[model samples]
Target: MRFFIVISSLSKLLKYMYYIYTHSSMVEGKRCMQTNESSKEQKVKVSGLTFAQLKKWVTVDLGMKPYRAQQLFSWIHLKRVISFHQMTDISLSARNRLDRAGEITALESCDTIAADDGTVKYSFALEDSEVIESVLIPDSPRLTACLSTQAGCRCGCTFCQTGRGGFRRNLRTDEIVAQLYGLQSSSNDRITNVVFMGMGEPMDNFPALSDALSIISDDRGICIGARKITVSTVGIPGGIEKLTQLDGQYGLAVSLHSAVESTRLKLVPVAKTLPLRELKRDMKDYISRKGRRITLEYCLIAGINDSLEEASALAEFAGDIECKINLLIYNPVEGAPYRRPDTESVNRFMHYLYPRCQAVMLRRSRGSDIAAACGQLGPGARND
Candidate 1:
């Protein structure tokens, strides 16, 4: 009787699986899939706008006086208005007009994790009910905010906790910029640097990421230089090519955790889709056009890809490319098979890279007490 029941369940499960495989395309073609975008009209974040765009918006759309644009910009960004009603400097009539146009980005701070070392991790609620993380690291004189470009990641890097969460959706420019506002407004330590190395792949969400960078770089606004901003990617082709067209002096970091193609594919699965040879070529072209050095991030894992031979190969791999190798100590994640390499092995690997390229062994920052190290930020933390 038990055998018969088991067989019946197996048969039913197989039938459903067969139907899903056959009709998968039909499910994908539906516009209103699972996202909340199905209900509310998609609104851009106010933090994502530049003074020029805001000026054009106020003058052309709202039919406000030219000087009013400057006042509005001051009220929103400089004053850090928490609510629309707080834009008291702007006339009620004009504010009502702007309100009707759906111009404001409604954001609510969800949660914050402040480490003993003054590193604060903030989670912001998006209009779509998805949450993204932004981290502020204050090392006295140098304050850095690690920002995210998407709600979740699609890069599928095997070593990453956030990437394992799978792709949710691209965050708007406003969502990205709101992170800066949140950090600056909440913390006393002013952020001097920003790195797009948090939750999602920055290059994948190119337009929104670029817009967020522009808003931060605006002189009359936050006024952060392009040099102070670092955009990291898993080596997307179209994104890298598009980056060449832009004339910003921002820094770029490539997550080149392994030099070996097979090993890299095992770690960063995107390598299978965008292989190293082509990626190297696109990156070389980017360096030529931009005329700047790029940072190659290498994560050292024990007994896996950190052997002396692999280190030597990595040196040869980075040869004369206008690049610097950032040897990162692998931040251990729960259920991850690999362990962090010892100091001896890490030094041996750095010795090989030093001869071939400009290299620096960036020590993992504080926050291990709170589990905020590299690849360690997520709901799935090791209990042991």
Candidate 2:
């Protein structure tokens, strides 16, 4: 009787062990499947598509009605919904289909630092875990949101902290528009102006920039006026030509730190390839085609490009084109071998160009205290 009882006990123990092992294996398999699905979802960035593309995808690819496309567009771009589940107007089956198709990745606000001034700086977390920074400058009636076009810049402008970090990758069109949407959602004030002057060079990422412009300026979408959006570049001739070809009424700002070719080359290494004369001609052509005045962004670095002579050269360069000169005192970047001009020097420099240029405005560094000022944005940047 004792032997029979022991035998029964052993059988029960063996069965329990087998069940535990099988359960563990099943759990592991399920986890692996979940990971694979997550990765697949990451690959399909629905936000990367424009409204028109999303409409086509839904109507043609997902076998949904054409009207559903408009709803989807409004939900993502206008409403800024993070998930298809939040799209109440979309049917359950259609939502599931859209979910299976891809994921709608929105920019997560990692950190936001406000300056003593009314400027607010936001650090956005990308889908790939990379971070980009944007600035919101509150100027009473007109609130300006400065947007970044690339994760890091390759322009190699010595004074720019973004270039100091080296290039990562150009931001997609959706990523560009996401910045505007994110800002609108966060701020109480409406964004009246958008400037591509945050981190990277806009012209370097022209295709994405153009698409973003279209979505932002579209009345059916974000509804920002084309004139209110300004794209700043370190002078790319091909990009200027492309902008002219598109006949976009968007404003253009050239980062002409120094009007002299050799001086400009030193300041903007990319200028070595894109000479001042060629860039000048392209600007003239763009002005002629678009019938809009270009803004010359001159970062006046003390003892470097803030000399009266450089200012005069800049005035001469602006002679033919109807342009406004935005004289910005260099915002100090850590490790950058440059300094901001004193009040006297800044005034002197602007005084020289004031007579020659169409209009000259001194741009005060808004978020310099938080490293959110012009030429001061990058991973390496720190707030003082």
Lowest lDDT 10-residue stretch of candidate 2 = 26-35
- Tell me how far the alpha carbon of residue 209 in candidate 2 is from the true structure, in angstroms, after superposition: 1.3
Query: Which residue pairs overlap in candidate 1's backbone?
Result: none
Question: Model 2 TM-score?
Answer: 0.87
Candidate 2 structure quality by residue, lDDT tens digits, 1-384:
999999999999999987775444333121223433665546456776767777766655554666877887787777879899999987786676677666776776799999999898999998777799999999999999999999999888999999999999999988888888888889888899999998898888988888888888877667888999998889865988887776459898999999988888889999977798899999988888888999999998888888888887888888988888888888888888998889999989988888877899998779889999889899878666
lDDT of 2 at 335: 89
lDDT of 2 at 39: 52
Best by TM-score: 2
Residue ranges of candidate 1 with Cα displaced over 4 Å: 1-44, 106-108, 382-384
Query: How far off is residue 152 in model 2, in Å?
Result: 0.9
